[model samples]
Target chain A: MGTALKEKQEKDLQHEDLLHRYRNFSARRVLFIILGVLILFVLAAFSLTLGPADVTIAEAVNTLLGMPPSGTVDRIIWNIRVPRVLTAIVAGAGLAVTGAAMQSILRNPLGSPYTLGISQSAAFGAAFAVIILGAGTTQSTASDAVIFNNPYIISISAFIFSLITTGIILLFVRYKNASPATMLLTGVALGSLFTAGYTAMQYFASDVQLASIVFWTFGDVARASLWPEVVIMTLAVLLAFAYFFYKSWDYEVMDSGDESAKSLGVDVNRLRLHGMLLSSLVTALIISFVGIIGFVGLVVPHIVRRIIGGNERYLIPSSCIVGAILLLASDTVARTIISPIVLPVGILTSFLGAPLFIFLVIKGRDFW
Target chain B: MKLEIAGMDFAYDRKLVLKNVNLKVKEGEFLTIIGPNASGKTTLLKCINNILKPKKGTIKVDGNDINHIGMDGVARKIGYVPQMSNRAFPTTVFDTVLMGRRPHGNWKPSDSDYRLVSEYMEKLDLQDIALREIGELSGGQRQKVMIARALVQEPDILLLDEPTSSLDLKHQLEVMEMVDKQTENGLTVVMTMHDLNLALRFSEKIIMLRQGKIFAYGGAEVLDPVNIEKVFGVKVSMAHGSCGPVIVPESCVI
Candidate 1:
């Protein structure tokens, strides 16, 4: 009789220990994601309505749905505003997700495409195409105005050079089995090397060539065409996001440390290599097309992390939506804030993101 | 599971860390390794779990060579808890403990996984801080969290490196008692220790290492004053406490 009572007590204890649900998956995170998507929708709609020639949201939606208020409104909405908004959404989402993945794989908070020197390498490639390959020619209208003879040549060159940097880093990881710190150090060294190469190209270029180089360096979303470029960016960003979300659990295991991660059956080396390769490819694709947008990649993931905590399942998707929100919002303000004299969205993002990142570091709760 | 290490040698760039080491641990035995600094205690533990490749020789679990077993298979049999360090990313306590279920399932934890994690968290008194970031927890709390993580893996052999370091007296007793209870339930535990008294009190068997070699290996009687002086270059005495025999360091060996 005593043993039967003891067994019943033991069963009761086990039942008491079972939780209703894991705390990591909370209502707050899902609500935050839904709210983020809503904000992105509003931002995209609002942005389409802003610009030099105003179009109301109804007209924008009408044009987007294949009926137009007028031909000129169709041109403005289809040719100008649609591509710009779509580019911002895809480019912003891609870069921010890549940044989060890079930070996790490299195990460094400062890890991003910009910090890892992929952007500098692309800039060097663009300069090489402009000055050496004669991809840009001066337009007859103005002394400083240069037009691209073939924009594809410049983009292909930039993409190739960025891959070269990625190749060198991967070789180190494969052969030397370099640690994350060592890999990040190699990136810093390569960044400086490419920066020097860019300066050297600028020193010998003609005035028109130099102007073209500077123009290509400014990150502008309108440079892309509507048909293939935006479509390709969308495909790549979705693939990358899906891959990251699928691997979210492995990334969470990795947050403990490499040794602990390995002990838990994660192939740390393989994951690091694949993560770096995919992130670098996505960053190169965006930079080669839109030039170099700064700070969005580095800052959006951090903001989401602060709000929802660092479970990657929620963090990856939230960063994608929030990234679109940040970049689209920045582009809207850039174009509308100065009237007809539109500033490059890169400049505006830096101006805003730098102070916001600083505020987070100084005043927010300690995330790391 | 029984663990057998035979003729193992490990070196780092021509400097030997573990040399010609061989030992055996029976199933359900609690074995503690006590050694001084740089004595290869951690290295031997790592080799048993295949974290480090040995220069020569084999480590077998349940008579099957662990080297032949794939990482997933090895992880199923052996759960390793590394020494505690501050994590850079902010992960919640529940998630960290839940990660032990990785080898058993995919990215999404099943209902059983959550239930197991909850059980161990409750056992370790970690349910109150389930949502707190791991970085914010005190050292003792973090150690318990790590131990809880290993427990949820449900491995037959558990390897720990300095599991009680930096903990207070009460915490140290609590951690040791938790592990002791598991060993009573047919879990094989191997850990490294700096405190000889705790090792003597709880370790069913003990291995004392010196200069990358096993100086002594036997039951708890191996933790004598002379062996302590020889291994650590410290003179010591034995005293009895409420728990069991306790080693007291008297002075450094001249």
Candidate 2:
């Protein structure tokens, strides 16, 4: 009877432990997502006020909501600042989430939409359109968000060509069941191959075309101010993000390695295929609008993983938030730092991201 | 559950690894596979777990072909702990073990699974470092974590490939003894190991493989010095120790 009493008490303690663990796990992740969403919104609101025209944050918010901000503030807020900032948030969020998925599927920390040369190939296609086929030039710009002069044709070509790179990579992965190193090497090799083709095309381009091509490759988020393109990017990113959430649990297990995941009954090849397809789709969507925005996809996920340990459930959403904040804040600085000069958003990300990436490698040397 | 393998064949790059391997494992039996480097022990285990599909054969669990069953169903019945886990990321020990519950269709780890996993973690003495990174743990600790993970699956059959390869002698005996105790409840145990003495002491049955075929299969009587020398090209003697027949490897012939 004494033993029976002890067993019953032990059962009660075990039950309590289970409930406590579940509560602790879920509460932390929920708080993280809530905080991320909050930060992204605040960053988006403030970024809208940062430009040569000098609209204050409150004025920008008021103008956004159809209130009074004096004359033509609504037009500038509606036409210019709102779309640009929104695009930056969308692009940044998309790239980072895709980065998280890429890293998991490839089992490599450095995996990203850009790492697999999707962005480089997209740059080649967009450059091809600008230089060879005679596209947009920034010589006659009144408003600074002005790189997307030939929007329709350029966007389509970039989207199509990015998918082409994704297809090649997928085909390669299917054949050898490629390792992470192989994927990285193949991607880098593919990038060089496309770079060679793009360089040859540049030689035939005239001086005006060459200037436009240079602007496009530097990742101008300004190009996305065309409302229809912004609408497409925003809609697509959100939808793809939803899909990633559904696949997050599978990704968490896959991080252990393919054999372990298979032992756990996960169809590893299918999961990787889904991850690659969705990530590339998100990459194609963003790269089409903004030319090769490097490092956000590669960098933001690493930072998020370091902060909160690598559970894909929290990792995916937190990465999106951190990425959105990073891009929106950087794009704002890029616009206002030199006043009317307006450095490309891509240039700003590399300047910030490269040094930070190097520091992380040095500090957390054996992170993987 | 009863496991039967009939005419199982496997090849990698046109070189056959396992050929016509036939075996039957009854419920609650401890079976240890002993073989040299190129023998088909690992391939046979992989076939049973459905990691690699044999060229032509059937692995039936209680008379149902493993191919007919979904991989999840196969995973539900058999918990596999492979040799030398290549884990790079530092996930928590609890998270590592909790993945075993994934195949059982419980998304949040049902109360029972949590209870069972906790029990196994405690039994394995892994509760102290349950929240620590798997990568941070010593090899013996990680091996225990792997055992806890496999145990948490609550599988009818537990398949291990060199489960004690990294463990020291003390932990090795502890794990094998624990597995031995669990088999009293009709849990099927199949594992491959290099230590024939442990197999002689702990396992109910042993299967010896040479090249791509089963050379011998039976009780400890099959591990005679002649058979050991023929299979492994090593000279060894079996002595009647206090525990059981202990295999003493004298020297390698090759």
DockQ of all models, two decimals each:
0.64, 0.52
Model 1 chain A worst lDDT run, 10 consecutive residues: A137-146
Best by DockQ: 1
lDDT of 2 by residue, A98-124 (tens): 888888877887788767878878878
| Residue B81, candidate 2: alpha-carbon lDDT | 87
Runs of candidate 1 with Cα error greater than 4 angstroms are: A1-25, A66-75, A140-146
Model 2 / residue A120 / CA error / Å: 1.5
Model 1, range A36-104, lDDT digits (tens) per residue? 999998889888999778799999988889999999999998887888899999999999999999999
Can you tell me the CAPRI class of model 2? medium
Each model's number of backbone clashes? 0, 0
The C-alpha lDDT values of all candidates are 0.87, 0.81
